[model samples]
Target: MTINLTEYGLKQTIQKTITATEQPRLGRVIEQHRELYQLITATGQRQAQVTGKLAHQATSATAFPAVGDWVLFSAGDDYTTLIDRILPRQSVLARGAVNQHDGQIIATNIDTIFICMSLNADFNVRRVERYLTIAWDSGAMPVLVLTKADVCTDRADKLRALADVTVGVPTVMCSAETGEGLEDLQPYLTAGQTVAFVGSSGVGKSTLINRLLGATVLATKTIRQDDDKGRHTTTSRQLLPLPSGACVIDTPGMRELQIFVGDLQQTFAEITALAADCKFNDCTHTSEPGCAVQAAVADGRVSLERLQSYQKLQREMSYQGLNSRQLEQAKIQRMFGGKQAMKRVKQRYHRD
Candidate 1:
């Protein structure tokens, strides 16, 4: 098939770019069940991986193509060709990898992120904060989706709580059982758009997907009555196309969504905004004169607990961002020595 390169800034003509061995294909990742990915090619589905120079460049699994990525590769009878290049992503949804110090690309070209949370036992402002931080870092617009609305009491109260946490992002309350709030979510799932759902187990992520698909495409699990945590039903991240024309990727329920060290400033915009108003240029907001943040807490403009939460998150991020090989090394040496650590050291030395 002939392809145009004018939009992408290539000088080659459309017909010349089409090669016999290499073909352009629109493929969605059917399964990430194994280390190898099952890509749904036009001719048929094929198991593919990065090899040769590409494999060497992929420092982490996330560096390779992810589910929802449209790539160009050579087709074969037995073996699928390595993806030569990844098309520019419209958006990316990522989070800190489990137990790893780096970020993991959850999905690419996502238009919106459904920040799922349960109405019952798993409800947490802190968890939502983490999800928002990661979502903002991913460069995708985030929408808060509260599931199990049918079972929760005072549903309006829950929405208000999410609104307070999100501040600027959209929030919707929905239940798979009753199919509530599905219509509110439709505008974001228009044709050619992509969406991703992420949250801890028992937050009804799968249930919400099943409802949007208008069928039981994704498995559902019941939350424990005592603790309100749902058993994980989806084990791998898979992209599913909706009959309505959009695409959605369902991910495994995350037990621990760690934070990468550098996103602290972007995640808490409110706190950052308050800091700009402080009288002292280096005010810590604890008891500094003309502290805008502390003054906000005193005047009820901001909650004390909210400031405390912000401070706690900042500290956690600092700890995670330490450059030492180990926590003990950071404590004893008092100098983190990784690339970031060295940069800090140089900055301090050079400062007047």
Candidate 2:
């Protein structure tokens, strides 16, 4: 069965690059295991593995093919495929890997991202801010989805509290059981658009996807009754196409969400705008007499907690940026050292 590439969000730029060659076939990666992939091609879905050259040339995990990536490959007679190269992506959503200073790719070529948080015990404004920072950096629109609304009693109060932190971003209160607030998401679910559902495990991400899919296509688990914490259900990422012509990618619940890189000022626009009004050009907003941000906190215009979250994310980004630069410098030094050693060997040979 031939599939329409445009329905999977293929753009003219990529369409123009497609060649009428038989050896290399074009397809979109719909599933990814540790080292294997499942691609949806014009012919049909096929299991694929990257070519040795691609694996050898990859410097990091991000260079490899991820779910939602378009790749070129060659098909084998035994129902296997060999991927050659990945096409350029229009947008990608990623976060910092746990216990590492490297970026972890979550989904690529995404148009929208649903940052899920349960109204139950899993809700945290600070965590939502963290997700927002990474989402903004991903070049995709972020929508906050507050799930399990039926269980929460203080819905209005919680929404009021989130209003201060979720500035400019849309928030949808949804209940998979009751089917409330799901229609509000229609604007983002237009045909040809791809959206990803991401949040910590047990936040009802899979449940919401099941509701949207109108089927129990993804596995889901209940949270512990005592602490209200969730267990891992969806172990890998998979892209599913809906009858509405939109695509949804469901990912495993993340235990930790570290920022890889993002536009800090954009995420905290309110704080940045206040800083612009400070009397000093370089006010740090930390006890400075002319700090407008501090003044706002003093007058109850901005919450101290929000300002602190902004500062904390700013520090993390700065530290990571410095580490990345240092890593590059060390790599360059190693390369130059090898050249110097080879030059010394030549000099010794001439002298002898």
Specify the highest-lDDT model's number.
Answer: 2
The total number of steric clashes, by the backbone 3 Å criterion, in model 2 comes to 0
Per-candidate local distance difference test: 0.69, 0.82
- Cα RMSD (Å) per model? 9.1, 9.0
Per-residue accuracy of model 1 over 103-181 as CA lDDT, tens digit each = 5667776778999988888888778888887687565799999888888997777676665568778888888889888
TM-score of model 2 vs. true structure: 0.86
Question: What is the alpha-carbon lDDT of model 2 when measured against the actual structure?
Answer: 0.82
- Model 2: residues with Cα > 4 Å off, grouped in runs: 20-24, 76-80, 279-282, 318-352
Clashes of 1: 1
Model 2, position 202, has a per-residue lDDT of 95
User: What is the per-residue lDDT of model 2 for residues 65-114, given as tens digits with 9 covering 90 to 100?
Assistant: 99988888985666679998776666778777766554678998899999
